[model samples]
Target: MTRSWIGRRAVVAATFLLALSPLAPAAAAPPVVEAAGAALRPAGAEVVAVTKVAERLTDLSVRSPALGGRVVKVRLLTPDGWNPADRRQHWPSFWLLAGCCGDYTAWSGTDIAKIESLRKVLVVMPEAGWNGWYSNWWNHGAGGDPAWETFHTVELRRLLEKDWGASSNRVVAGLSMGGQGALLYAARHPGMFRAAAAYSASAHPLLNTESINRIMGFFGGQGGDPRRVWGDPVAQRNIWAAHDPYYLAHHLKSLPLYLSSGDGTAGPFDQPDALEADFNRQNKALAAALTQAGAKRLTTNFYGPGTHAWPYWQRELHSSLPILLTALNVRP
Candidate 1:
């Protein structure tokens, strides 16, 4: 490890390694490898350790007791003007959630890092399991690896606010599945975020039987028990409803909301993403519900020519970010 890893990440790596091979001597180094599960995370320990991934990027791992003490990772994109050596000023936060089948790195290489070229805030991207859906699982009513909602809204927020100098003012956004997460978290937490944005979000799971099955199928791919996530559509509709943005839009009346999607048509960017088009419909449907509820601070652009690909999402993030940044009072 270099002098750079001397920061949070290095300390964490050393701590875990020590916990794993306590009897080994420092002179006889153990193979630096990841533990099979939570082998490195002992019980009753809560620590958020940071490791450098790049010049301005860091990988933060937290001991999550909620997920059975599994160490969770969240990648942070520090501001261009950020100086770790300086502790006087704090950065407002912008949390970018990734879609299904994507990890924390999904938001990388996009124009998001340039949202405010002045780099006025910290950008945090937490990993919700590939098919996690960013929801606390029903697990046949035994709500439990991936209690993503608890991880992000509570555990992660506290770690960042206390240790990372993250300000209370914040915004959240995501694309596709993550788009739904942005809306769900904002609504569920009520005042945790000042604003929320979702692009091509899976805004409605109960829109139809087929939509329901399709989402359940994705959840199935993630675990042995698909029904464990939210249970039967008819039987556990409340659980599904709780995770659905359309049903929860009323809770967002006071929030600054940005919703957008295309008709899944071929645009100048690329051909249609079938999944994107499908979810675009979901987004449109959710928009209608929100509108009916008269969500006061809503902004939308239901463009009909794009798909569920990164180009459109990147463009959307760049376009709608002013709304979020302005709400966070960090607009550059």
Candidate 2:
């Protein structure tokens, strides 16, 4: 037999043997290739599956190393003409975070998907655990697994920008627990988001005893040990202060910010007598601190009569869109 023919037969035989070998290294496989031949690098976090929920919405099941190799779902609301297969085109990103007990579907469950102004933007809603608090758990200072901050800001951010066609320009908005998350992210990661907005958020959880106590209650929810989050409020005061937006106001002074909250009383959306929400006071404290820190472009809509609810948050979303889109250089 000729040398070339013998070589071809040997290669085919090796391929067949490798396919049947039980000791094959499947975990060491190369990157995933898209329909358009774009390769998704299997680095930190990677999307393993995709589901098209609607004409505009696509769900990505990402395997995250930050979350200890746990798989998480991230929903994307793609703009008109957005195609993951097309690597040449990219769009600005809008990160909409969920509250304490909510999931990634919170924003999608609302009417945000129908907004016409967002026709050219990509919305990213990630699953930040039921009580993740947008933080890397202190875990008594070991600081491992359930590192939400690392997952969202590092792994997921790179994955989206590289494979999902998201550009560097981004804006963020959230309500309640998510509101706190938005502020923390913006203040902690300077220049990451063009603008940020918070509606009835726990902005100054370390502002006073009331705020601290209330948040401690939240940290202990879902039967989770409160100490696992940020450690003892007294022992880990530095950690608490680090995550508190009030303490990080200086970091946000240069960015465009939108802050809004109600006095907790009944308004257009609530019944005759709605109890005042503690977050109103917390948000006010945050606004004052931001202003003191020289936030020139800050917008305050402390619309006195409302309470913490979806109707008000929905209204604030529309109200803050102008600022967010303006920062994005998009027409509102």
Candidate 3:
């Protein structure tokens, strides 16, 4: 019975060891292991989750009591010796996101992990489950979940900062569908985030009514009213306007903005028919509209040979990182 066994809360019996000695001699003590950052294994670009996230930077699967049965899985990326309460002025963070039917772990597993050179800034990737839309479902019909917008914008931010030392200055960005969320959240909550970036983001939700319908069907029924989440695009034009990044072009001038997309020719979403042309034209029009609105201090990139896939998003993020740093003013 050595002191190491006591340190780890393992029950050690010398009698058991003596009994085993009859079969084989006592083995040498293994190295004393510390349970600090030692729990994580170094993956190529990402840190593998080891221990549970009760104390520090780890993946946490939390059921938001406020949002009914909807569960939020988050990967809390933190620096070494991270303390949530210690407010020593850390770098601002961005909530990197994924598309519809994507989980929280997507960004961490994707190529975006390599672009996270600004270690001070932590990225919290939260899962928006099947057709959650990151918006609150109307009528409380599907699981009676409160608006997810409130949960992410208000609750999740406060929780992470208070418990995980996540900085107050944060941006929310994503690819495809999440791109729309990042833009919408930034436009709606103008003062909340310093900058918002979206790559191949679904620019106009109202335009793609049928796709929205299909996505909504996963939660409850087909063609369910979207205003339940974002309000009537017609009657609630003001609310929908608040989310239109192109319409709110003035707000984005000073606030950092990044937009990028691939040619609508190769991706799964890009059905090579008139439907694809409509989406492409709409997105292109949005970008052009922002430019025509005299929106300044913004960067927009279009990839020629790429399609809407992980590889394209990876490249986009790599290119967008420098711009994000400049916007957030994070050096090194």
Candidate 4:
């Protein structure tokens, strides 16, 4: 019995190391660590329902405490032959965030399903709210419900990590607003992700006056007080600073970062008259800031011809596979 116990500890120790090793594939289920208050919620939070949407697609409705105990939809795209029922199987996780006005189905409609590297990862797509900004509302500095930050980073994270076959080795990617979210989450929660990729991200919303006002307008248009999102830009400078990627670039220094965007010019995928240069402008500033901040690892693609559309984002998403897969350690 003592010999058997020693062997079990050795295997468990090796599995823990594999979670951090880039070249090693993930083990089955992660070794159960001592759970604290909220981290234990994953084991307790009820998986209200699970529906298999496709051979590889499964959608679930989870009652999340971070979302004020409201039931939200989370979609999962499993790799080939992935089985969630097998307690002895686990896979690395890839979180695909959606942009404004998008939901769990955003990335589903794209050609991402065809990627070969996907076979090694479990993709997580969560509802970030209609215009959640991936943040807990500032509520005029009072702070309140719709805690998107807590929901995604804490609540949902625990849910997937504990219940689903998601391992600690993870990477996040998104487009447009979700592009901002990918950076925000990575910067705000240092070491939570191995790397982050943003396609047409708004990396530096507070970099300039025009950008500031533009973000404010976006916040206001979505039917919420602008101050409620991050408080007044002046009085609550710290709050805004906390949310802006440019200001928080230091946290991303150690992680593999990928930033991509176009100059809003019409491309094969967009109409001739449409221009989404604002994102291009922000993406450039972010790239510059990350550089100035001495971020040791970074990758950028400022491809200057596309607009804010799925085609451009889709292409970038595919192009970013090398970086994304490398971060997840699914590739060399």
TM-score versus the correct structure, for each prediction = 0.81, 0.84, 0.70, 0.83
Model 4 per-residue lDDT tens digits across residues 1-332: 12211222111222222211110001112112112233433223457999999878899898876666778899998877677777667788899998876777889888767887887799999888766788878661244357777778877777787778787788999976788899888877766788899987768776655456656655654345655677676666677777778777777777888888878677776653222577678778888878898988898888878767777778888888788788887972
Say which prediction, candidate 2 or candidate 3, comes out ahead on TM-score.
2
Worst 10 residues of 3 by lDDT: 19-28
| Cα lDDT computed for each candidate against the true fold | 0.71, 0.76, 0.56, 0.72
Best by lDDT: 2
| Candidate 2 Cα misplacement greater than 4 A, ranges | 1-43, 140-145, 271-276
Candidate 1 global TM-score = 0.81
Please give the TM-score that candidate 4 achieves against the real structure. 0.83
| Candidate 3 structure quality by residue, lDDT tens digits, 243-272 | 545565555556667888766565543332
Question: For model 2, how does the per-residue alpha-carbon lDDT over 1-332 read when each residue is reduced to its tens digit?
Answer: 12121223111222222212010000111211112112223247889999999979999999987777889999999999998889998899999888877788888767888899888899999998877889878762254448787778778889888889998899999888788899888887777899999987889877655455556656666555666786666666777878888888888889999999888777986643222357778788888988888889999999888866777888999999999998888888
- Candidate 4 colliding pairs: none
- Indicate which candidate wins on TM-score: 2
Look at candidate 1 and tell me the lDDT of residue 213: 52
After aligning candidate 4 to the native by TM-score, how far in Å is the CA of 269 from where it should be? 2.4
